[model samples]
Target chain A: MNSQNVFMGENLQELTVHGKKEFPIQYYADELFRLPGCQFPLHWHTEIEFFAARGGSIKAQIGRLEFLLEEGDGVFVNSNVLHSFSQLRPEDRCRCPNVVFSGELIAPADHLIYQKYIGPLLSSRQLPCVILKPSIPWQNSILSCLDRLFSLMQKHALKEERRPLPLLSFDSPADDIPCWEMQVQNELNRIWQLLISHAGEIPPVNIEKGEASLQIRMQKMLAFIRSHYASPVSLDEIAASASISKSEASRCFQAYMNQPPVSYLLDFRLEKAKQLLSSTPDTVEEISRKCGFRSSGYFCRIFKRRTGASPNQYRRETT
Target chain B: MNSQNVFMGENLQELTVHGKKEFPIQYYADELFRLPGCQFPLHWHTEIEFFAARGGSIKAQIGRLEFLLEEGDGVFVNSNVLHSFSQLRPEDRCRCPNVVFSGELIAPADHLIYQKYIGPLLSSRQLPCVILKPSIPWQNSILSCLDRLFSLMQKHALKEERRPLPLLSFDSPADDIPCWEMQVQNELNRIWQLLISHAGEIPPVNIEKGEASLQIRMQKMLAFIRSHYASPVSLDEIAASASISKSEASRCFQAYMNQPPVSYLLDFRLEKAKQLLSSTPDTVEEISRKCGFRSSGYFCRIFKRRTGASPNQYRRETT
Candidate 1:
């Protein structure tokens, strides 16, 4: 929320831990109507995510596969998968809850329990995401678990302001639950037992590894450009981050971000220049240098072109 | 289940990882009437355990705090705490479900979420165990979570023999949950949120650190004697494991196991010999050396005295 843009890391990782180190999971509910494009852009995190469109319809894409998540329907994304969510009708309401968690919370990586059961699904190259419809039985059972899990999140989120939950410590009698810790673990293990037992039966997504990795490298190129924008970031440096030729890097930027490398860099620099003008007391020359422009005159011309106002005028009006 | 004895480790730790390293939780149901003397002897585990008596009343002691766990009631034992459970009446059936888990499952130890909310209750020397009855509201909520959790365990345990669970990956959709991974983590976090909110009101147990450490030392001593039984483990070594005098060590063995240290060691060696006699082709002299009985004559005399049969006769009958 703090960053104005969706910032992927240089290695194309989301870099957020997702949840606590112990039980890697986190909950989120978003209204797409408020977002810049009524969608979260293409980004990949190592943690698997469950995205549900709770209100109206939404468009989702995992790798090259694109589909609409009908209201009340959800999708299960695999780890290291590139995915995005958007409102089908951004003019109206489109709300969603994204639940992200690591597979490790179900089982450890080293154990045979994990390898024999959980690992196959995560590392399956043939599958990237699964669409869950309520009409199906086994999928419905999975949805039911998720319903309880997320509904609890909604309820807790609502009550969090007023409630100080009961701790397990009991010197005298308090009204807290006695053994919830046991129940959560038990439920999760059982849920895993249900999922892995029928993994082979589910149809494959047929998504290619190369296509996914291409988006990943594209993201790395974007991240490299974003981070080094204040310095004189080059086409060579951007290409090297994703390990591609310079022309291939330009082609990636044009394909994914709809701009050539230099244009995107200029847009990024202009955005930063505007931010600095409003937030800092630096002079025009200092701000230009800080934003990676070789000359203040060039910076002023680009700033006027992008915003129809000089940096100082834009800052003055905004402030 | 594989080992015939309750094996603690040399560091006074129970080395079992409990559940998968990712989750660190496991479930067990025991019938105390089936156990020796209708009781599980005193042992300290680093993981926290929830001991609930489902069928009959049972005696439970966490650290110095000893009490009865009435039928339909449960107790929460903190980590690294010494605790024991036994039937209040050995003649009748006593069934219990013991849910053991690491605190990491709630939140990682290093996080502020864990330190501020969960850690205080765990590291508090004044608290060891909390008793939970059905009458208290908050405590009942805690028990409800446990009930649901354990009920799922019992249900899954039953279905596990027959049902194959659905995997999340769906190409043709034979039916699996789309987002169960999200739910499990969501549920666990919500459960933690509820637990920590009411911690301050729970009464302290007043169990001293010195007393808990004594049980800890006693356990290390027992583990030392058990692991080194095949060698010439002396009283000095046993005493040193617990950092106590030889007389004090002897007293602990007598108090806890209801025997002197040497007597317990002899019984253990004989048990090992009996197992080897039936399982292996080792001669009496080799068995004697392995059991640390000093000589075949002494080993034979002790074996006969305890089992009322010669080593060969016992081996013949058992085999």
Candidate 2:
């Protein structure tokens, strides 16, 4: 698997244990170029993330909300929100600079800063993500900060290459101070302050007990789907995995995923089949069965409708 | 107030509040290019720091221990250890890449990573600083990690300048993920792990109660000196502020700073006088009095011996 793809396992609830246990900040600069009809799969992590489009336009999905970010546009994903991105045009490549860091980088839970700002935003259900449009004053401020930070990081790297290799010595200087690192830390804090202050203007998401429980159920159902995607699955089984009624499962998926349970299952199966088609030389009948499709004819019909291409064609073009 | 100079006030104890209230990770990258006799003043901060020599050689003093660091040499300063730096030669210009961050960045107080590794190393009296020389395998590994991290930071920054700005829209796709951020986080973690594992190899420092109390008293005396540096102060008053005997104060200064209390005071006064001479147009007599010198003749004598020039000549040359 490409390291660029953050998804590690079949599960949608991604436990993104970023960095090592001692260091928890994660950073990535990825150029995402997708063929038309190809979608990055949905997954969620506890780390807060910022995704900025570097070239062309891309569509980002945070929960059920969709945002179309053109070049220079960006978005912030709050912790544990289901989100993904896709290139808007088949012919255009979408390059994005993305950063994901543990909220602990902002403040520890016991600290006043965490309690006053970061805690409220993280716990709030309504502000799961914020769209950073360059046109909006506050959002534009954030984009500029992000841009400056990225540039500084680049300068630091360039300096390393241009500088001579250090010689070894046992004598450590006591007056060595890190001025650039301080600048980076200051910039990140400024960005956080902007986000925390703006979070106050947005209405709090009133999450009812029933709604909260439903979200948990949906997560459980999604996990079930991921694990059983290649096997024969049904709405009854999905609902049973979450200990919810079949109707409730279907309603929950429809509400959050904007698709019925069976439709989601079918789409997931088709996505798996498409992957198999491109990566493996399995016959259509074998691929269809392996991906939980009943027959090659039905698989072809659904794949064509969703991807605008037959399974064989997708494989040939993408491969 | 050159930004490169980390010293903010006259107090020897620097309570470096890094980042913001909500974030406390302070970072700085300072390049030290000094003429012979130029020195970064002695100071201590609660934050931990890493200093890597980029070019030439410099002398670093931490507490009573002094080390001559050649290019590529680095050192880690544990929390609250007095340290200073000076250029090794009149013609040499030393460029160092230094990083200072809160120990909290490694792990919060409640975190196991802190309790198991960071906390012990920080609170230990013996491990106030560690010299990182390329000749030592573990230290060399740490230097390599630091180099990699710096390079990665540069890459992230450069990517921003190389890419075009993003445009905004509401139709977000589901495929954009940050891969580079993850890479950075991973590298930082690797560095932390190496540090933690190697920390066990060093012996624990045994601190005596008398020595600890002497340090506290010295801090009090230093604070008093900062507050009264511009006044007609004496050794008796400085010792009285810390409720210690004058001889004891002198002994403590000699032990830790490698100078008598009065000598430290004179050097400090001369440093202040130099700053005033260059920045303000006050007459030499007035500036000498303001810096707590008894007479212009004595001040000129000390300044010439220390800085290799008379007050008027130094001001004219520097200005």
Candidate 3:
């Protein structure tokens, strides 16, 4: 009944069903300007996501690859892919109109549209995300459909103007639902048609059998770091969480993330510290310790090196 | 050697080869503002075309279907599809950055990308043209690639800035050819990837055996009408051109074009008359007779009804 922000924490995004147990589509149009650091923390969802950049350049990280999308650009993140977004420029706010929907919206398991097109794309390991830029013909066609859908959904939301925006919860339609729902479905199907046609062209990255397992291991390590970032964590401890040797963990992180486990851990802590510095009224020393920094002096040094501002200065400026 | 506009006449465009035998690709970037009525007449090319609307709304007709593309909108006209471009609003001159490249540019017939992706698309009877609106995600991506290619090609072309403009004849060897040609090829391949991914989604319009034959008949009728529209033509004479009965020809026209055979002929004649009126110094009587109208009075009445202008008025306004 109400628009709920699905907190995507891990790899498998458990989509929140609205009315029925089987319904699997969720639409969220959120302004990243309102979020801390204007970013969504790295997470993956089971539902495919269509993220359109309304304004400013948005940086999107899908799996291990990252893309900088300018205004009017969009990216389609395939299901169960690790992805996140941040404003390219910190000062400029970005709004992403997103549609996270299950593949079932277009076709059932037996349908030709699904078996022929949607199945291959959702199952592709190589195509983690497709960046939609306005200059390319097919990509532009998909974006056009998305823009229309976003505008229609936005208009409908504005008309209701409820306290908590109504989650697109398509199954339980209120009596006063806007007539544009059919248009939204049509546009989505059009996008699916485009996706299916070009799905094969996305060269399948020869993901060796070991690569998937390694990705899962790296994912586990990431989850561990996320859960225990506030505690003093070591490379060995992170490796132990995934039942791998420290060197293997280091190698896995380097292979997938282009960073060592320790560096990723430190960066995660710094991000958490930055969030705390802006959101909480805690003193710099307390915040540093809370974010797993050994000392406020060391945290300040790393924070400035990463964010171009000291803890006090960042807090002051943001506040 | 020199920038040449490949005069696309009728349906099967026998591409004009320049400087070499069997040149596979021909590229032209032409501004329609300087041309009379700011439009390119109905024609089709064997090579695929990526037309990006630079400014204003451009109206494109592919086969019997028409689409209005706004600035920043692009359309991909599939190989050998009868298509034409015109300024949607005659007063507003539209600049189209066009790339007419053969399928060979991306992959040879024996190559996997061509065999798997390009071959099916070029040979598909169902897909005539794909209109790339900037709002669609995948299409937007292709358009983005095209825009970059156009800019790069434009920059390269500008360096020479010679009279008659140079055709993007890729076979010739120049010191700087490799640099920009590689960029062009890269961008085109990028476009192909987006295209091949989405091409399958365009459902094969179940085209029954009867329907496919009818389409071929209709295409032949169209070609015949195009060649013979200038002279006094009758429904029987047009029908004979495609070796079909008069009633069958009428039925085919109604089915495919949604108009009667005579009505289509009259409309085609009127279009010719309009072109002659604006482009030449011919009198209304002379142009009407040349375009197959029985009388100037009848031509004036039909022209006014279709275009909301008398022959002299239309000429004055356009000129």
Is candidate 2 or 3 superior in lDDT?
3
- Residue runs of model 1 more than 4 Å from their true location after superposition: A1-210, A227-254, A258-266, A284-306, B1-3, B7-39, B50-57, B61-66, B69-77, B83-124, B130-209, B227-255, B258-270, B273-319
Q: Give lDDT tens digits, candidate 2, residues B8-90.
A: 35565664555444334433444456522546666767777777765578788876567888878888877877777766765
DockQ of every candidate: 0.12, 0.05, 0.01
Give the poorly placed runs of model 3, Cα more than 4 Å off: A1-42, A53-61, A66-73, A84-96, A107-120, A133-136, A157-177, A201-210, A280-289, A295-316, B1-319
Query: i-RMS, every candidate?
Result: 8.3, 11.5, 18.0
Tens digits of lDDT, candidate 2, A1-319: 1222332345656655554443345445554564225455666777778778765788887776677888788888888777778777767755565666666654466654567566777877777788788888988888877776555444452254352322211112112222333334444656776776576665454444565566678778888887787788888999999998998888888777778988888877776777778889999899988888877898889889988888889989979
lDDT (CA) per prediction = 0.68, 0.66, 0.68
Query: Best DockQ goes to which candidate?
Result: 1
Model 2 is docked with a DockQ of: 0.05
The worst-scoring run of ten residues by lDDT in candidate 2 chain B lies at B165-174
lDDT of 3 by residue, A157-238 (tens): 4454442442332212333322344344446767876766566555454445666577678778887877777788988899
Supply every candidate's count of residue pairs whose N, Cα or C atoms clash at under 3 angstroms.
29, 54, 44
Name the lDDT value of residue B38 in candidate 3. Answer: 70
DockQ of 1: 0.12
Ranking by TM-score: 1, 2, 3
lDDT of 1 by residue, A1-319 (tens): 1123344243456665565675566666666776546767666777877777776888887775788888878788888877778888866676576667776666556544456566887887676888878787777776666665555444443244342322221112222344333333344555465566557677777755477677778777767876777788888998998999999988777666557988878977886787788778999999999878989999999889877998889889878
Candidate 3 CAPRI level = incorrect
